[model samples]
Target: MVQFRKDNILDRLVIVNDSSSEVEGEGNRDDHNVGTCIYCPGNEHLTKPAVLVLVQKEGIVRRLSDTEDNRIDDWCVRVVPSSNPLVSISANGTYSNKPFYSEPAYGYHYLLVASREHCRPSYIPAEQWSNVLVALQDRVKWLYMQKGVSYVAVYMDYDASSGWHPNLNIVTFPYMPPLIEQEVESINRYINEAGLCPICNIVSMEDKSPRHLVSIENFTALCPWAPTYPYEFWIVPKRHGIQLLRMTQKEIDELATMLRVMLGGLYTALGDVRFSMIVHASSEKSRKQLHWHIEVHPRLVDKHGLEDGFGVHFLSVSPEYAASKLSVASRRELAKLVGIT
Candidate 1:
């Protein structure tokens, strides 16, 4: 049996496939292989030149980039162009309104090397996560300033079998993605009707609910009321914000702490499972109405025909149960990581 659930703000619907099945753990820690990996610290020549690099020297961090002849080996973080980019800068920006309306996929794509290590089961330290976020902010802000760029997408896919090196994908789009456009419309509708941001209300409401996982200084991690995947969770800011570029250093550090703690808790509770982390924010045009957030979706099962054909998600575990298990583990992890106990 299944129960249909609708998203709180969006018109999205999901089906709880089985409310009674136990949430089983699935993940394994794989050994690191640095010899053949290209993203490692010493193999900078295997990929394109880095667009941005952060190097720490004499207790001061310096921002540098790779030239055709030079590659900085001593770096904390690096951003390089994707070898197989999703979009190209030299693409023809032609558009036609014919039956098969199409335009060039004109944009940019880059890879963010989040760590010097090749592969690891554990999440990066909070301080290193802070550095990664700062680098991300720098790239996102720069991309938004370019003409014709409408959106910047940041996400990470981590799987043990895929040589899960700590890296993130940054892609730019000339137009708003359909899902984000829908969210913008929904957010504006809620603001007009309820006179408050829906995400702010959600944070306040879920702060004490069973779906609430953990709350760090300025950010909170919680399971959504209706999730598309088992054990899906989101990290959102307590205060309303539009873009990651505007985050202060303090806020970035706190957000990094929240990510480290929550992700560590996830691994502690569920082992080394595969997951995707996505950043959702409004484009420049709709920035005023949307509240940005980071969503983590653990890939626990495969999708079936009903989900693909009907646009309905089937979830094996309910958000309440997931929150119950994750909150306890995450809280303990947080205590150990930050001495909250």
Candidate 2:
């Protein structure tokens, strides 16, 4: 979740853990599809191999996509790593363990399959919702087991946030800035204190704690703090030394459940918005030290604005009123309009 250091006018490319509540408004963004919403879950064959497992009380098993699944269904929230991935999780955790070192970035990326139903998270029942969390836990465990993976992170673009699609994200990566020693020295003398990567602080919160339990539902819209936009929120798992690719069955089930309410709330608020989700983790499979979290971004605009001089945000409304206007009934009506369950 790194923003542009300069901040002249950051493009959409550097959106690591950023979310927006009101759209900025654009020139010809008519390409948005407000008609229907489709997901991946019941459509097992349509997605990649099960990166994580989600089992219902009825014993239904589902996996998230690996950024490879083209078609999805209503019963699932398929995930896909970037076709042009930037980070690497194949290396071990260089950020956490001082003694352990491997390739710059040797980690893995896994997709999160939200549910077996097409409806929004609000529509999902409580158990199934918990299943989503359990699946996430299972995947987090699996990622840690890898020899090269160092970290695993989950993400989602909830409702109008990224188009209101209920899904999960996972990311595993290695921290290797070329001027490593110089960077440390520079920070120590001028910035503020000794070796301090602010993220390192959060990482330390659960760096060694296994029973790390972070609530993803609360926060400034289920996304990371300082969300680019107003309604960004997050759900990072507290397990310090685990990845998100390999999780226990129980964990996977419970994680899925958490996603249900998180997403469902978005649906309950927004009216069938569109969104996306994915996982960010260490590359190359090197096991390292890093915490995991799930993020949610709702794309909604209540009032129009001028952040779009050329053609970036072009939102139709303001965030204050938009957040107030969006509600459960409206969301349900929109969900039905889009053919969501």
Q: Estimate each model's TM-score.
A: 0.87, 0.44
TM-score of 2: 0.44
- Across residues 99-167, which tens digit of lDDT does each residue of candidate 1 receive? 435456667878888888756425698888888999999999899999768989888878866554688
Off by over 4 Å in 2: 1-48, 57-105, 158-166, 176-227, 233-262, 275-295, 301-341
lDDT of 2 by residue, 3-107 (tens): 211123431222222222233322111133344332333434533444444333356656543334433343333344432233433223323222321223444
lDDT of each: 0.79, 0.42
Quote model 1's TM-score: 0.87
- Provide the lDDT at 334 for model 2: 32
In model 1, the worst 10-residue window by lDDT is: 23-32
On the 0 to 100 scale, the lDDT of residue 73 in model 1 is: 94
Runs with alpha carbons beyond 4 Å of true place in candidate 1: 1-35, 285-288
